[model samples]
Target: MSNRAPLSNKEIKTRFEAALMGNYGLPAVPIASGSGVRVTDADGNVYLDMIGGIAVSTVGHGHPRYVEAIADQAAALAHTSNLYLHRGEVELAEKLLELVEARGKVFLCNSGTEANEAAVKLVLKAGKPYGRTKIVATENSFHGRSLGALAITGKAAIREPFAPFGVEAEFVPYGDARALAAAVDASTAAVFLEPTQGESGVHPATTDYLKAARRITSENGAALVLDEIQSGFGRTGAWFAHHAAAITPDVVTLAKGLAGGVPIGATIGVGKWGDVFGPGDHGSTFGGNPIACAAALAVIGVVEDEGLFENVLALGERLEANLADHPAVTEVRGKALWRGIGLAGADSAAVCDALAARGVLANPVRPDTIRIAPPLTITAEDVDLFCDILKDVLSTAPEGPNHE
Candidate 1:
């Protein structure tokens, strides 16, 4: 008998397209299960996932502690609306504050977009009564795809069609301190930016720039909001990427890896920003789902008790060092497990397909940029294998991604 399962990729795709929306079109394979950094397809082919669910799987797939936390939480008590409070929700919020080493208030939500939306609402509502209206964001920065987040998102192709974005926001060059300062004024409610630009190819914000934003926002009484959805939670060497800048922002949005793949997001407000919202301001139905909170708590515990931060630093150093010297790679940006690769003469899409063919999974975040956000728990051997496969894909290619 054959080792491969009876199911085929075409069969799965057909059924999936029939029942699901057209947004994702069709995935490469139907994943049945995953362990550590690898996933097994329905047809039983195993592939190493380097994207880590786009940076959502912090502790890797099917981590024992993460699994137990969700299972235990569900087995006990599951969903409770915001009208009612739960231990998991409270504890998760407290843990978030502790991890950042800042005094803040937290409102949990379902995803990264939702967290950005909530943060926007907090800013808009707070500023409305105070005569502040405009929000400042940087070019090439991606907050989320939701309406409000889309408004603040700096990508024109995605946001233009969805124009009349409802929110008043100004876009400036990402790293230019002067351009950013000029864009903000007394009427500006907030300045939203990513500590490291992930969607526009993993560009890191300079520490001086972060400090300037912090200083300008403080001087002008506008909120400085750092979108850490991708760079937070040990994805970077530190617990949070902004910690490297050694500056604090007014409001910080978090998601993606918060619950180690569980769907959860959080909007954290520091000091006065924390008190911006009052009763009946905002809420979420399945935001702080007990299972999600339990999962987040477990991820945090494991990250701390097991000293994953130190590992992230070491592994990040290794990944950057190994990939930077590649001839085809023009630049390596971002920190730790989250990185963006600038391809010299390869179609990132074709490279991704080639990687998939070679039993590795990654994403073409941009046409010329390949993003690798593997699980934090991935071993040194995994990094070596990924780099080796990528080098092979580049060398053996007949032409760029558009050709063979």
Candidate 2:
């Protein structure tokens, strides 16, 4: 019951350890401030932020435009609840629709989990009188960890704990069009796939696989839902990674970089499915608040106005090209800033730790795979610096047990 404020990193860590749950282990660094693509720890150590808060900060930290927009929105009005219409929400939805360029309507929420949940509800509602309840998702896919999303997520370790939810889902091997086709049936309500599997080591879906899913889902009367929570909003150089496959999904779930760093999620349904939810079907109290919508509008404007997509494309190419020839890097995968570097015989965790110790930050999505999802605005110099640091870290990283 101490009301005392923490004065140092050590004090803050101590307070967190005592008061917070240990689900995320412990934060490696106590960050005090961040700007552009860099963050400084309370201990005065600065590090290049390659993770971008796990691909959430698309426009990068403390962008002046984003700051101004949030400030202006807060000054004018913050929350009016979803019962009332707000101009910022309408503007953001319109901008998102223009970017996707498919016929659709958006349902806003608070996070990736909520977005997927909203999508699941919509699909179930639309397919209802049909008695379709099954969903088809791919193996190694990582949807958010909510009950409904967890059931659809392919990872058994996360789904097994909540068996009583009674949500039936089938998982097929990723990148296998035949397997995906075989899994969907007449009773399937939806087929969920990530354009690029983020938490499962950045595995991009093949064009054939995506097209096959689109075809099979349509044939089976199932909605094709693409979870672009991690790969959307210029993370993959394109507004949506599925654009590369040249197939439009029935539903698209988005979050992550939508509002730069602000927490927001959107479940957009294309064509007829967009109107599945009526006035009382689904809603969130803080979903389309003026502040978050304003933030998203600002983020979208900056991405387009500043041409961050081209930057992502150029930097992503350089990143992959530089690492492609590295002896330690087995394979470099992904398009744009969302990249996965597969290590040959080395442990990715050790390399990530080594990189962190050398004033750089990267993450190991799996034991053998490290994901590098820097901001869309990351510069060529930043990519070069990251490559140099990674090369040095790989050269000196100790051979040890691998833990993801």
* Candidate 1 residue spans exceeding 4 A from truth: 1-7, 401-404
Please write out the lDDT profile of model 1 over residues 298-402, one tens digit for every residue. Answer: 999888888888887788888888877788888888877788988887888888999998999999898888999888888989998998899899886534553
Runs of candidate 2 with Cα error greater than 4 angstroms are: 1-6, 401-404
Worst 10 residues of 1 by lDDT: 395-404
Q: What is the lDDT of residue 96 in candidate 1?
A: 92
lDDT of 2 by residue, 1-404 (tens): 55765367787788789999998877877888899999988778899999999999899899999999999999999999977888888888887888888978999999999999999899999887898888888888888888989889888888787775668889999889888888888889999999899999898988888888888998989999999999999998889999988998999999999998889999999999899999899999999889999999989999989999898898888888888778878788888899888887678887888888899988988888889888788889989999999988888767645433
What TM-score would you give candidate 2 relative to the actual structure?
0.96
Q: Which has the greatest lDDT?
A: 1
